[model samples]
Target: MRLYAIGDIHGQLDKLLEAHDRIQTEAGHDAVIAHVGDLIDRGPDSRGVVEHLMRGRDAGRNWIVVRGNHDRFLPAFLERPDWIDPGLSSGQHWIDHPGLGAAQTLASYGVDPGLDREALLREVRRAVPPDHARFLATLPLWHLHPLALVVHAGIRPGVGLLDQAEQDLVWIRQGFLDSDADFGPLVVHGHTALDSAAHHGNRLNLDGGAGYGRPLCAAVIEPRGAHLLTGKGRVPLVPEMTG
Candidate 1:
């Protein structure tokens, strides 16, 4: 089966939609689409993004969404408004990064962000659809395929897939990014942003900084390797490579 891996969306619903359109056109109806999470925060339409994906899954589309650091914030904040420990919920640190875009998310649900914390919490709890919360709660930390290992962030350099920590799968950087160690399966991931898809010998970084005002990307992977799905069309991950 053909596999299409989408990079970090981070609430850029427009970009997400555009990327999916391209995927559908290029990968055909039977392709499995894997999302590298971070579906919320840092953009204008987190709610829309979640809802769109939910609708697609409900329609029997083959879609998989992995858990992301920003995605965890919603549940944590919903469970406990004070769950803000800079490292935990983005809500606690929203002030430091207004780009968390919580207000836009609230706005999407018709809840006023100006309400008191408790009142806003109540409104948000009441406003957000239960299915959306369930969707976020049920996301897997990683998706493993024979040809590709997909995760939100990168994996721990030397850890076996079964033994890898969830934290590292969704949040790691240095060790995974800097290491050139073979990861068995070709790693397809999106936590670290880049100008475009970057292909290391062992892994491919697909995050094009969608939430940071760049295009959302989808990498089409075959047994041979991967290609970036662009507006013009599919392009090889490594331009110089030839089959």
Candidate 2:
């Protein structure tokens, strides 16, 4: 199967659609498109994103999404939440996970570390509907396929995959990106979208930070390596619609 891995599509629905259309046309046949998460939060149409993915909830549709740290942080606030002001980037995880490193981890795609994080955090949570919330809540921290091991962020250095911690898989980065560690399989990631899918042996990054108005990226990966997919347009990134 020709696999396509997508980077972050924060809410650029139009770009996502364009990317999808391109995938259908370019890939053809039965190409699987997988997302590395952070589907909402920055751009607009967070709801639209959720709806689009939710519609693909049946068999035959080759779509898989893993939850990024951004996706999980808000929900962590909701689940094991500490009373955030419904306004700031103030959270236990945000505070606790201090070693996360380099604000612009996904810099290749114009992920501004300067984005009003507090506001962004608040807005992102408010936009997620119950259905999407449930979906987010249930998302797997990692995706293991025959040819790929997909995770929102990357995995730890020395820890075995089965023995790796969930927090590291979903939130940690420095240890994953800095070390010469090799995951058993080719790990395709989305959290740290550096330049061109930084690959060191067994790990690849595809997150283009679509939420930050860069481009929604996807990759076509097989045992032979991976291919890239990107789309254009803004998707009318407005603020606060419904859920």
Candidate 3:
């Protein structure tokens, strides 16, 4: 069974579908497609993206969806409009923060984020479907495969997978990125976007910053190695080639 990991989608539904088409063509319909989360925000069609994935799951497609920090924004804010994640984009509200892209997310649901706080929250609550809210709120932080661990962001160094904090699983950076520690299975994540996929030996980052107008990336992972699934076909993904 081949495992393909897709990077942060950030509401890029077209790219997500295109990647799915390529995966089906290259690896067959039975291949497992692991979404590295951040499926919403920063793009034009958050609602469509969520609906498409939901429908796919309903049809029993081989898909794995993990939670990303941006995935938490709408649900958290809908619960408490004043909520702010105390991470990198601390202080600013989720919708107001350029990096978070909640405005675009709300817009996808036909809600105007420019409305007053109370009105905005009310409009969003009315716009978003109950199932969509439930889907975002209930997403897991990680999915452990025999060959690799899929997560929205890299795990914390020096901590066991069971002991990793939820925030670190979705929003961490500082300690995890620079470390050489091995967590048994390869850590596959997408939070920190790079221009291309990265193979750091111990971990793999597949985010190509689709939110920043770059391409969405996906990698084909084998038991021993991996390759970037491209339009032209597989490209060997190695530390030297990535850097």
Candidate 4:
């Protein structure tokens, strides 16, 4: 079967649909698609994007969606847990650090990160149905294979993949990936998008903030192999914010 992996969708429903069509055409038949998460809360059509994914999964579309930091926020919101939505305002989840980076990002963009949690709840509810929430909840933290371990961000160096906490798996960036160390497993991640997939000895970051209009891209990886797929440019990024 053709095993295909795409990077974070970030609610770019049109680009996602385009990417799917392109993948289908390239494969010349149906194939498995493993998504690296961050499916909602940015761009437009967050609801539509997730619903499409649910339909695909329900139809036995051999898919794996590893949980992303953005995806992680919903449960906390749903359960009224301690953590707040860190990835707000900038329109990117993992990048919007609630403690430090979020403030700077909002100031830079002249927007308020303090959009009420209650309002956010209502927006999410309007966009996402119960089935979609269940779908998001059901996603795995990582997809491990002998060849590669796919994660929304990346696993912490020296940490066992299975033992990795959700936050580290979804939100961690440079400190985790830039470790002058190896993670033992070749980690394929999509959280910290770069201009191109950064190829360390074992870490592959396949997100360049495509939802930001840079380019919704992914790296197709196999043992002794890798390639980039730039999906159709339907994902609109506020030009100012990207700068």
Give me the candidate number with maximum lDDT: 3
Instruction: Encode model 3's per-residue lDDT on 1-243: one tens digit a residue.
Output: 468999999999999899999999987887899999999999889999999999989999989999998899889888887888887555898877877788899999999889988899889989999899999889889999878999999898889889999999998888888887767888899999999888988889989999888999989999769999899999998864222
Rank list by lDDT: 3, 1, 4, 2
Task: Show model 1 residue runs off by greater than 4 Å.
Answer: 85-96, 239-243
| Collision pairs in model 1 | none
Best TM-score among the predictions, by candidate number: 3
lDDT per residue as tens, model 2, 16-50 = 77777887787673567778887655555555776
Q: TM-score order of candidates, best first? A: 3, 1, 4, 2
Q: Candidate 4: misplaced stretches above 4 Å?
A: 81-127, 230-243
Model 2 TM-score on a 0 to 1 scale: 0.72
Q: Looking at candidate 1, what is the lDDT of residue 75?
A: 75
Candidate with the larger lDDT of 1 and 3: 3
TM-score of each: 0.91, 0.72, 0.96, 0.75
lDDT of 3 at 170: 94
| lDDT score for candidate 4 against the true structure | 0.64
**In candidate 1, where is summed lDDT lowest over 10 consecutive residues?**
87-96
lDDT of 3 at 69: 89
| Model 2 score (lDDT) | 0.63
The alpha-carbon deviation from the true structure for residue 120 of candidate 3, after best TM-score superposition, in angstroms, is 0.6
> Model 2 Cα displacement at 112 (Å)?
23
